[model samples]
Target chain A: MSELSHRLSISIPFENDKQASMARKTMAVDPVLKSNELLIKFNQEENKLICQFMGTSDRVIRVAISNVIDNVKTIIECFDEFDGKDDVQFEEKQETI
Target chain B: MTQDLVPTAHYESPSEPKGYDFIPGDGPHSTIGETTKISDIVINAGGQDRDTPSEAKDTALGQLRARLTTIQDKINIFLTNKMKEEKSSKELKDLEKKMLDEGVDEGSSDNE
Candidate 1:
């Protein structure tokens, strides 16, 4: 009935500014599918990554937040597993079409 | 938007809890929108830094990992179980339609 007022904001911190920016860029790439029903924004503050969500109803907001957290975990895992190592080159070169 | 942005100086220290209003998903399927109808939950943590303070990287990592995992597990179970109600609703509609069609058939047979 009312406008989108249900809001949730999540802030995540990283070791440095670069990691925070990386998370923001990666997470912000995907736009909210139902903009009228829900809205999401990604921001980086120094070593922290921030996510804000507003939705028409609680249901929409919860689902959207869960999905975002899942993505965040994956990024955290990446940082945990391979934070500073150089990117590996495959033994054989593959041509890109 | 620039409207709600707060300066870094005003942000709280990492050691302190940002104290965001946590709304655990309501009902079995994380499917309740009732509570937030009138009031909003707002948590202002130094521009949203849930990360543990820098003194303990191990503690910070564990805290962050624990939080993400908890949210993931809880939501996954809720979203999975919430479909039961939806499925039952569809089945109920189908059963209603069948009963209506059968009633029409019974009436025709009575005429015959």
Candidate 2:
């Protein structure tokens, strides 16, 4: 019997380090789908979140990559939502509380 | 994030017919071949034609920005709800502790 392996790496650039860090934190909390068959890693460098995945088959690798991409999208959306006008609103709400 | 990125325009090489001059026997009396006339036909050369127009590219970029805004709004709603839930849970815990302490205080006063 022989083992097949596949790997994928993707770098998502953000506007700033804060955004990248937030993305890294969001993605790091989620556990991998198939722990035995796939592995996922995330690293933050300046304004980019570097993602890597390894799997036993092409399907697993692709699935892992897509899942991470979705997470990154959510994180970017969060940045766009909170980084400007929303921050002032959030602070005002906190003060009222 | 992936959806927000705008793709640049792409072009493909224009398909032009190749023209060649066909000389019939090589002397001044030789008759020109039929294919030789193809050389006289003007053919525009150089540079590939754009597959997508500039207007189309602008529209696509606009659509991508719109979609990104929508996604951001959804995320904002989700985060707001999460914060509200957390605040309410914390308030509930504080109220429970206050009630417990007051109960103990009342019991001690009654005993004294």
DockQ of 1: 0.08
**TM-score of each model, in listed order:** 0.51, 0.42
Q: Top lDDT: which candidate number?
A: 1
Candidate 2 lDDT (Cα, 0 to 1) = 0.49
Q: For model 2, how does the per-residue alpha-carbon lDDT over B1-112 read when each residue is reduced to its tens digit? A: 3333321111111111131111112121211122212233342454443321111123322333333333323333433454466578779999999999999999999999
Where in model 1 is the C-alpha error above 4 Å? A93-97, B1-20, B23-63, B71-112
Best-matching candidate per TM-score:
1
Residue A86, candidate 1: Cα error in Å is 3.7
Once superposed on the true structure, which residue ranges of model 2 sit more than 4 Å away at CA?
A1-4, A86-97, B1-112
User: What lDDT tens digits, residue by residue, belong to model 1 across residues A1-97?
Assistant: 4577556676677767898899899998997898988888888879888888767655676688777876776676677667877898778777999
Score residue A76 of candidate 2 by CA lDDT.
Answer: 53
By how many angstroms RMSD does model 1 differ from the true structure? 15.6
